[model samples]
Target: MDTPIRMLENTDEATKQTLENVRKRKEKFDKFERYHNQSIWATIILTSIFLIYLYKTVFTVYSYSFAAMFSAFVNDSNNLTFLVCCVGMYGGMNLLKEKKDKAEKEYHDLRCEIVDRSKDYWKKEDEWKNRHLVFEVMKKQYDINLYHEKK
Candidate 1:
């Protein structure tokens, strides 16, 4: 089963090459998965902090007047944009991870195609060799007949 497709009865280069490619793709996909997971955790932490800060500044803080307190809260919101940007980057990185996963699936499917094509190629090669052998035998017979006629 492991040695299903080969040129003759010797080597399984097609399977070896396909397995190597699958290994490389799996490694690449795992690397991106790690990065994506880290980014997701970071984004969750940052968003939590942002929400807590917003709640404290908007509700807990007191001033002489509601207008003045609301103004202060609005002024402090300038840094919230940075947190938003961090979350956005995490989302973008997750999209990249999805693309890498799709590529890995494509590479995995290629293994089946490699085996099929290798079997087909070997079959054709054997047929070609048989035809050549028959042609050679016929040519020798014809040459012998010509020599006998000349004699």
Candidate 2:
């Protein structure tokens, strides 16, 4: 597929369409990534809240000792509900993470294909490198001329 690099060398209808496809794919990839990150943060925050609540309710009630807190936590039947919720949240987050990874992979694959199809990519890169080298040489010569003129 003709990508942006190819378009730079030669712009046409095909390259335009390819650019559009790249744009759409990028957006989809970004959306999936955002959703995955948000889900993970939500899971972490909710788990933290549950922990805080459990700590306050159990530790305060049963005394500050580790043994007391552990006994209370293990014996409390209602703690099962919190456990289930944590497990469910973690599983859901994993699913979202997987989807995000897939989207990222697809995006990178598309980018690689674009680069491969754009025949002028290496040529353009070489041109830039040559230009930079020429500029550096010119700068050094100018500095030398200035030093000699001052002397």
Number of the top TM-score candidate = 2
- Model 1 over residues 31-128: C-alpha lDDT tens digits? 67777777777777877777677667665665467886677666775545856676697777779779777865664455345334544433556554
Worst 10 residues of 2 by lDDT: 142-151
Model 2 lDDT tens row, 42-109: 88987898888897889788885889888889888778788888889899889988888887676566
Instruction: Evaluate all candidate structures by whole-model CA lDDT and list the values in order.
Output: 0.53, 0.61
Q: What TM-score would every model get versus the actual structure?
A: 0.53, 0.63
Instruction: Specify the highest-lDDT model's number.
Output: 2
Model 1 — which ten-residue stretch has the worst lDDT?
Answer: 142-151
Task: Please identify model 1 stretches exceeding 4 Å from their true place.
Answer: 1-11, 62-70, 111-151
Give the residue spans of candidate 2 off by over 4 A. 1-10, 64-78, 120-151
Which pairs of residues collide in candidate 2? none
